[model samples]
Target: MSTTPDPTYHRPVMLAECLAALQLRPDGRYVDVTFGGGGHSAAILEQLGPDGHLYAFDQDADAEQQAQQLIRGPRGDRFTFIRANFSQLHDELGRRGALGLDGLLADLGVSSHQFDTPERGFSTRFDGPLDMRMNSEHGPSAADVVAQYSEAELHRIFGMYGEVTNARTLARTLAQARNARTIHTIADLKQAIQSCVPRGKENKYLAQVFQALRLEVNEEMEVLQALLTQSAQVLRPGGRLVVMSYHSLEDRLVKNYIGQGKFFGEAEKDLFGNVQRPFESVTRKPVTATEAELAQNNRARSAKLRVAERSSLMLS
Candidate 1:
């Protein structure tokens, strides 16, 4: 809103690359589906003409506050912030009679502000409540997952989401530990599974454990899949889908959806054997932050960006 981003908010990762991928048209309509700190949303607003409109979405209340601040600022007239998850993109837009967007951008992974806030419990670096809810107001917190999930449920999430090596041991340890004491905070969870963590890789091990809990609590994968499926439906022909994912799991889903039009399996073919795909990859490989960006923003280190363009051919 002030034309200057809050220093504590997320710094846009690979900003230049993402803007270039969008190929912004002055009068085009675009959506920034993960408006963490309004970094990308503000940038998109800059590219839009007075006739252009930008819709930003976020489930986080903190982000909604930031968006409200932006909407009261200089370019407010051209921007609208939807306080909802991107998974509801279609319905939200349709309700406003706004569909067929020219482009959509999603920068995935936890925001810097979320991770840095000790109370949010996203980072292992801090000792705080094991909350980790992006929206914060709804859904089960990470503490709930750690305290209530069965050994098998914990094992499944840790193994599948975090890809932790000793997930089984960690899950068993947590189930046993929680019975003795409530795993209500980061410190409690860490102490509970300290014995299961690989000694030399404590940081990485704890990160994986936390990641599993965070993903399960938020249903991140399911939400992401929903957003992708809706993107194919709401984007106009030749519209761009620019997504930046932080982990391999998200990147794999983005890659498969763009290349195959499905999260799994091969692309379906028509009677003539022509593949029926909704979008075509603009980037054959996921782009990463340049050394210059990485030097300035350590958070960009794990970011993987992919771009796709909606197919011009109509589906039967």
Candidate 2:
């Protein structure tokens, strides 16, 4: 039987900050939505006494298995692992009869495992197949998008998500290349991108392309919207919704959701003077990693943590 190692093995991003934002209550219920390496879950468990219960959710089967091993230890009974995406949090919590959560956490973006593993296709450093599905069992691979999307659509994805300077030119290049032959591997894709863009800073250019592809492959923006909506609903009044986003696109969405219930804009008040908005922004500005943390973990540099508390507003 494999042994459950210490939480250090996973290296939870901004661990101290997340715990502080959570503000754990010994007797209150808590949820860790992205139980990637169980680092956050283990930390939350440590804070919980005998009566406190922690429910965790992770779509990846491997994450579930690791969580199972951790839960089987001394603190086993208090831990519950769910094999599902955080977007369906409301329904899943309802089915489990959970309510009035003390705190909820979502560590968004890709995990270390995805980037470290070559076949996952998240990193530009690896020369693997262009498969970037978070859940390999479902959804279209990154290659599918490159092979199928129209030039205009590809340009939009690269420009919007990756912030590529020459997205239009790159998109046209990709379209022409695909017409001639298929792009099967990361090396092939990188070479195609290099042909369009100059040789200087190749890694930066390739990274942006990969970012655009991964974001589209995972449908990250759509999934984030659903998860954030569910998080607001599932959290009880005054319950904290702590989210750590790695990219500006996601951080912007989180900021808007916290300040105003919708992404379009904050709701305007009528002459009747009725208030609107489901959550109150706890952090007006997103919190970033400390210099110390950034020095230790380069990944923390891109991490931005935004917190919100549930309000009395009822869904219409």
Candidate 3:
């Protein structure tokens, strides 16, 4: 049994890009949907002179608690931390009379806190229990998914979430191994995978397996879709929707939603021959981190930032 690694300080991805995309107004209201280390939130607060209000959301109990402590300075009252999933962001803000935000920032991906914490079961480097719930209070454990999900279901999960090359083979292997033994711990699951998966890059393969399990446990993609759909309605006209996605699956969703206003193709055209995209793409291509940022943070390698401004299209 190996001891857990020390929790490293989390650096927000594309800090400058996030701040610029928000287009902060002195009196504007803003939302940081994934306030991991509260870096982005703190930046927004700095831009907000006095009348600006910043509302941050983090589903993870640990993150929420940390955010409460982190925002304890002079500008504390201006920043409100909500301990709930951002899928229902609009409703949560609406209850507090926060309608039509001036801008919104959603750094959509697993946080460093979740990945570093051994007990969270997000990282393969750590030998923790097979638990990967973002909220920590809800959802089925990764162990349950590994033990209960059918081979086909597991295959779909790995293929969709992790983009694992041998998803089918891995899924079948998990299904076969788990039936004979109760796969309760992360070590048990990793060993089960290793039995079928030939070791080349152990870390890479384990990362994929862990990522698949985490996505299945948290339903991250589905929640992201929900949040994106709500963004068009919640943001004021000319308000910006800036997002940072770590993977292609998430980037595709963000790209499509911004361009077509839905996950699929564009809606029908009017007599004026307008394609009717609800949000105009601010950056034709996703903005990536600079060499300076990448040199300091390995996690920024996969980060892609997309920005869009709300169109005149009213909520349907």
Candidate 4:
């Protein structure tokens, strides 16, 4: 709605690079799957012709409210807000005749607003309820995972999702502690696992633990796989898939999907040994924020962007 981005809401990370990757056409249809603050959605609407449409998807109520504000703007008719997760991309788009998209952009990771809000429980710096569900209304909270998950399940997610070095020990410690007292808030969890945190490295260790719990609570990896798989079906030949990931796990999946058409192992091959793939890599490597951008936005430091183009060759 407004040209100026709301710093309090979210500052679009690597905006220039994302737009360039999209290669926007005035009459082309586009989708911004993670419309946190409507910043990027507004920018896309500005570049679109009257006939071009932009569909934005976000399950967060706050984001839905922001989309409503954008819908009341002059470019309202060209914009559609779908209050659903990107995992439902294909079905939602198909219903609106948005299939064969010109391009799709997904800036992955929690938004700045979510991270800064204490009640959202995304940040370790704040003391709040351990509720990290992106949709909030659906699924078990992080507290549920901490209190009910077995030691083995906790170990698996911590080591696999968080990449925590001392995951086994941390899981065992948490299992024992939860038996004695409730772990309902950020402060409570921190105190419960105080002995497990390495001295002088408490912040980093706490962050990893929280990240693991948040990932599990939201089923982020599975949802991301869904988005990547459906992206191929929604985009037309030569349509772009531009994704920005904040952490290594997400980046790895995006990279592998673009290069191999599958998240794990190698690409499938046809009878002639020509590799069957849905997309070809547009960016040989993940792009990082320039020093200029990093100087202005500290959060941009961890952002990594990758782009790919939908392949014309048919695949089973």
Point to the candidate with the largest lDDT.
4
Give me the overall lDDT of model 1: 0.90
List ranges where model 3 is wrong by over 4 Å.
Answer: 1-8
Model 1, span 1-316: residue lDDT tens = 2654575788999999999999999999999999999888888898899989999999999998888767887888989989998999999999987799999999998999999999999999999999999999999999988877789999999999999998888888889999999888899988898899887999888888888888899999999999999998889999999999988999999999888888998898889998778999988888999999999999999999999999986754
Q: For model 2, what is the error of residue 230's alpha carbon versus the real structure, in angstroms, after optimal superposition?
A: 1.1
What total of clashing residue pairs does each candidate reach? Answer: 0, 0, 0, 0
- Can you write out model 3's per-residue Cα lDDT over 1-316, one digit (the tens) per residue? 2111123536788998989888899899999998877777877888887888999998877777667654666777788989889998879999999979999999887778778888888888888989988878887999889988889999999998988999999999888888789998889998888865656878877877888888889898899999998888789999999999988888999999888767876666669987676799999999999999999999999999999999998666
Poorest lDDT segment (10 consecutive residues) of candidate 2: 1-10
**C-alpha lDDT of candidate 2 relative to the true structure:** 0.85
Scored by CA lDDT, what does every candidate get?
Answer: 0.90, 0.85, 0.85, 0.92
How far in Å is the alpha carbon of 180 misplaced in model 3? Answer: 2.0
For model 2, state the Cα shift of residue 33 in Å: 1.2
Task: Report the error of model 2 at residue 42, Å.
Answer: 0.8
Every model's TM-score: 0.97, 0.94, 0.94, 0.97
lDDT-sorted candidate list, best first: 4, 1, 2, 3
Cα lDDT of model 4 by residue, 1-316, tens digit: 5633365798889998999999999899999999998888888888999989999999999888878777888888889999999999999999988899999999998998999999999999999999999998888999999999999999999999989999999999999999999999999999888988999998888889988998899999999999999999999999999999989999999999998889999898889988788999999989999999999999899999999999997654
